[model samples]
Target: MVPRRILLETGLECFRESLNDLHAPATCATHLIGCVTTIFNFPPSTPRSNAEMDVMVKAVEKHYEFLNLAVSFVAVPRTSRQLLKLTTDLAKCDCPMSHPGSTQLHDLGQHWVNDMACKDVTTLLYFLLFVPSAILKGVNKTRVAKGSNKHWPRSISDIVPFGFDALVEALSQWTVVLANPIPLLFLGDALHVCGRPLFTAVTTSPTFMDRLISLLRITCANMRRPQKSEQLPVSYFYIIAVFLFHVMAQRTSQNSIMIWVRGRELELYPILSEAVTITKDPKLWPRTVQRDATGIAMIVNIFHAFAFHFSKDVPRPPGLHPELAPARESPEIEPVIRLYDLLSTRRDECYAPGCMRSLQEVGHAFQKCGACRKVTYCSKACQGADWKNTEYPHKLICRQLQSFIAASGSATGHPKDNFFEDFDQAEAEAVTAPLLAWVKARDAQKELQDLEKSMRGLAKTEKDEGAVEMIPDLRSNS
Candidate 1:
């Protein structure tokens, strides 16, 4: 026996290094397998408590996050498949070579991530910036190529066990992030960067969302039982709810909206509400809301549903759902600017005479302009005035802005004047109202086009006196 303690330490060290420098794939694999085997079969000879195990695992996870970051910036070998296989094999390996938990490594990675919900908007913001940038590409590539329904971790049976309610709660936390404007914007941009065509497979696929929802609900309902060995039950209901809202809010796949909600609610609500209402009359309902594997699974599924949209082969609703169609919210907002607009703006900015010399941009020196005290400027004069006539509107706005602002807390107008007090309360209306806005914008564009066409016809008819007008100019003004 190679001293179980020594083997565990060596394996853990290698696993850490592999995740830290993901480029060293072979080394990572060897270390990961070796460490897991030692832990499972031999158990640390000196013995270790659950807390110590958690510390070690957390250290490894931090390295994993770093690896994900590095991999996002640089290209790597076809490690997705290799990693999947290694993890799968490790899951099945006999004592001293696999993770000790009932759920396999695959299940742990697949589901446990959201077990401890995001603590606050800041963490959610970090998730927005880091997660999509890191995982979208890899997820899309693997999903598109394999057309596998396998989610993150490929198999939840390989890691820590979770239940559905836990899953739903975990996912709900992520939903709260998406509902935040700043994080939502970046995540949406990342989704766009990952592109739509690739996502068709996931959104459109039959049973992907449905199956995931079912799995999460079943898992979450059974979280408290120790007898339920194997699958970590974490209900994915909340995540599913959040996902359905996001996809439907964006008007992506109308097909799955009702099905996902109905199915998940049927499976999850009874259990989740129990967890949610546990605080009601604590004398009567004593169980705290701490969730098990099933609950966590549900949560992961919810986020996974929308996140699946980033992968290829997720189907879209070919046409809007009948109930969702006609006079409802609009689809997602258009790109912030058009290509023509960007080109024109860039050209004008570069060529304009008397343009501000102190505009802050990448590669420019970072400094605060004295006059505005809000906007960044390389020089004092540029910050002092926007124009001689209009006054410094930007400065005034910036002066009133607070540095430590939550996405929801930054309110505009007087409390009495502004109807909406907080972003969270306002999101439902703000997001849904865009549909009406889209319709108005669309109708306006059509009117303009029709007017232009009529004008062109009038011009042509005038040039050719021999021609007779078959149709009258039907401009609204006319």
Candidate 2:
């Protein structure tokens, strides 16, 4: 009945006041939710002017501000007991009221959490930083209490009705929002903050682990360039590799990894192979060749360990049947192999323009570019001439070239037939050879140490047979 613009302005003002106070009343929370719902439910069929859209965006921003404040409130408790009490109170306050098209306060809270996670970078960071610890500590307390006769007055379920579902939804939303490189950079501290709890939760929950693997595949596939000049940053690729390493390291159950590998092999293998090719190409990632190389090595080592340690669990090698050719053949791997072979065969070609001389053929000493060290020349004269040339001036665009190289390192053309044949052998020797050897040595040493410890324990038991017989059972009955 009232003018929509006037109603929106009033709601915004009330929401602003509530946000300004640390201890806002429950009514204020309810009022703010009402305001957000009103704006969202406004007629979609009616077209709006540019100015109206601007106002709508501002309203959405305000809604996020209110949601962020709610997370802060939830994070106020330091200990499990305090968190339990706060959660119980929140659950009570959040119960729905009888009204048309109205959501409960708790439902609103959950919606806000999910919405903030997808839309606001700052809110997402806060959610990652505070929510996981709160949930983990609360769950840990419940676990401890269950072992004793004494019980906690309240459980974590009292606070989070659906348990870790909210957290899972938040993570899923992150995958959707992180489809672009620019937003991936905004993830700044969230990755660091969420790492431990994320590792803990994924290892403990099969559903969480499944969601994380799905997220990884989506992120890797989306990392491709939509345009020639619009490639993702090298750091983004490195971050994905680091996350995969952490997940792999924390896995205690082999079944989960096996399931993931089998189900996701079609999607995951190519991305990984592509990652290896791009990182190894000096011309593609000029300045970051060493760092990218190291990252790729670590990732490959992790995969190698997975394959070596759990060979029985891993799926059978692809490309065994012609009828199933596409399923086994990877588009991402062949281009890399071809590119590597091409570069290896032409190892001595001068990179300088119009110079066809090869260091190997001419027996000339080659000089490397000091800045990128990616390209070589037959002589210093060619290098100087290339740098000074106006048509292809190397100095002006050296840094950009390095960035481009890093961005597109893994972007080879479509997959080739029979690409999977001898793929693992070539990849292991090229990318992960050194690191895999080191990992094997370390694992062997650990096994030897464990054997010695067991031997000593057996010796001690034999020497103290009488004493061991005298010792009473200390195991608890309850």
Candidate 2 has its poorest 10 consecutive residues by lDDT at 144-153
The regions of model 2 sitting more than 4 angstroms off are 1-163, 180-233, 253-256, 259-262, 282-292, 302-311, 315-478
- lDDT per residue as tens, model 1, 309-403: 33223333323222212212223322112111111112111112233231112223434434422234434454445423132234323322222
What is candidate 2's TM-score against the reference?
Answer: 0.33
Model 1 misplaced stretches (Cα beyond 4 Å): 1-193, 200-235, 241-439, 451-478
Q: Could you tell me the lDDT of residue 316 within candidate 1?
A: 31
Model 2 pairs in collision = 278-409, 284-405, 331-415
Report the lDDT of model 2 for residue 245.
43
TM-score of each: 0.31, 0.33
Which candidate's TM-score is highest? 2
Which candidate wins on lDDT?
A: 2
